[model samples]
Target: MNGFTGELIGTAILIVFGVGCGANSNLKGAYGKGSSWLYLCLCWGFAVAFGVYAAGQFGADGHLNPAITLGFAAFGFFPWSKVGAYLLGQFIGAFIGALIVIIQYWPHFQIAKGKDDGNVINIFATAPAIRNPLFNFLGELIATFTFTFVLLNLGDFTQGLKPLVVGFLITVVGQGLGGTTGFALNPARDLSPRLAYALLPIPNKTSADWAYAWVPIFGPIVGGILAGGLQYLLH
Candidate 1:
């Protein structure tokens, strides 16, 4: 497969597992309902690992997150020419993945709807636990900065067992820093799925919370850029 196809498929896989977990945890009548935060973090981490493996197997760099792609391109770690293709694939794939989750948890959504669960939006996107815009943005920025900086040191994270290491990184980040803002460290991961939640038909859906959307989109991008810039200067 080519880079575009690889990224699309990989991101789709990521969403399948990650958002599916969200559905399971939040939606009523699911076996995994009300799972712990650690469970959610681990599942998301493994989702990322499998996504990276799939992307690498299909001949792409496995940047399922636009922040990473743009940051690397800005610092010359990745080619500028491929940034558009990667971003397109990531966003489109994220939407597809979210749709799959909706289908998979359709019954659960209906059950929740019957009980008037009005905040199902969290199943598709991140939300601040405290609703502080500035602090929430900074939370994402600091978390993503730490994530990207460690990722830069990994070099070729898709190779060998590095994907597992990447997964571990995600888990630790979520565990340590995810409480305040749900750790939306990737714009494509947060925005595309949130958009899907907004546009798609789902029972008991709430507002897409577009008011706070900018935090995830710009925070991760800025964080990634700063991490890449620091790495570039050090090198």
Candidate 2:
């Protein structure tokens, strides 16, 4: 019911259901290789929508992503004191949800393609399948930028369309730009899961791919901040 509790619960559910479905499907090769993208985006977006629908009316602010909260804070939509709390809650939720993914999929870790230690962390976080950090970073930046831009355009919470716009923006970006690096648009979405993968017991793991970790964290946050700045200037 409180802000922190609402954010934590919402984010945990989002990561668990959204990332879980897609990542799990990827490991299984169920919808064909990487077929989980669309469903993943939809799940995340719909999750956001539902979370807001339930939590927003209660003055929850419902930022499932730290970047989202930070973006609004930069735009002055969120207060300074509360932004940190929201971020803390988001990460906590992400960490918890990531643990669930690791525990649930421990069995498939050994059998999943690219599951070796070489890309172990990649499962929890993200990486460029093609090894080109330039394009990978660019893809993530653009997607987050697009999401932020739309958020700004939606304006104040006069109608509740803001949340829907945010969801739609993410869904579109995932469709258009997700191919390169799976679009790690939210920091918690990647880092939390990556941490779980690094800690979870798995056989024949390669390296956890820690080298490519920061991109997801910094890229989306920067994108959100820049979008907030740009929106401020335009107004």
Candidate 3:
């Protein structure tokens, strides 16, 4: 009910949807991916919208992503002193979500993946559609900008239509840009699940791809700030 609680609970649900899709895809005899691209995208959008609806009044950043928080903080919407708390809360929530997901999909991990292939196991974390950092960064920047811009405009109390726009915008990003970077538009989306990947007892798991971790964390931060700055300049 408090700020941290809202963030923690909301983040867990958000990861559940995202990670649940990944686990469902690999279930034995599950056929080709149980969910489609569009389904997942809009699912993500509503996930945040609903999460915020519940937690927004509770004082949670409803941030789901560090970049948005940091972006707003850079513009003075969030407090510098509290960013750490928000990040910590988000990370903890992500860990719990990923753990729940892994438990929920234990059977599939044993069956479809045969407990091999770190790549298969990592859908719970995230992987890039393309390994190139340049394109990956570009995708994140563009996606974050689109999402953040929508948020800024819809933020005013006088305009009650922002939530729909943000939700729709999230769907758009997932449909268009999610194929790259698995669309880690949210830092919590990446880092929290990642910590789970590191600790979960899956048969085979990779290094969490630390070599490229910076891309998601910084890319969204950059994109969010750029979006906020542009909005500030324009209005």
Whole-model lDDT values for every prediction: 0.90, 0.70, 0.71
**Tens-digit lDDT track of model 1 for 132-192:** 8899999999999999999999989999999999999999999999999999899989998
Q: What is the lDDT of candidate 3?
A: 0.71
Tell me the spans in candidate 1 whose CA falls farther than 4 Å from its real position.
114-119
47-87 per-residue lDDT for model 2 (tens digits):
66665554465456766777778887888867888877678
Per-residue alpha-carbon lDDT of model 3 for 92-175, expressed as tens digits?
A: 887888899888766655655443422363466556777898888888888888778777776641125544565677778888
Q: In model 3, which range of ten residues has the least summed lDDT?
A: 113-122
Taking every candidate in turn, the Cα RMSD to the unseen true structure, in Å, is: 1.4, 3.2, 2.9
TM-score of each: 0.97, 0.83, 0.86
At residue 9, give the lDDT of candidate 1. Answer: 93
Candidate 2's TM-score reads 0.83
> Residue 123's C-alpha lDDT in candidate 2?
50
lDDT winner: 1
Q: How far is 201's C-alpha from truth in model 3 (Å)?
A: 0.9
Residue-level lDDT for 191 in candidate 1? 93
Q: Cα lDDT for residue 168, model 1?
A: 93
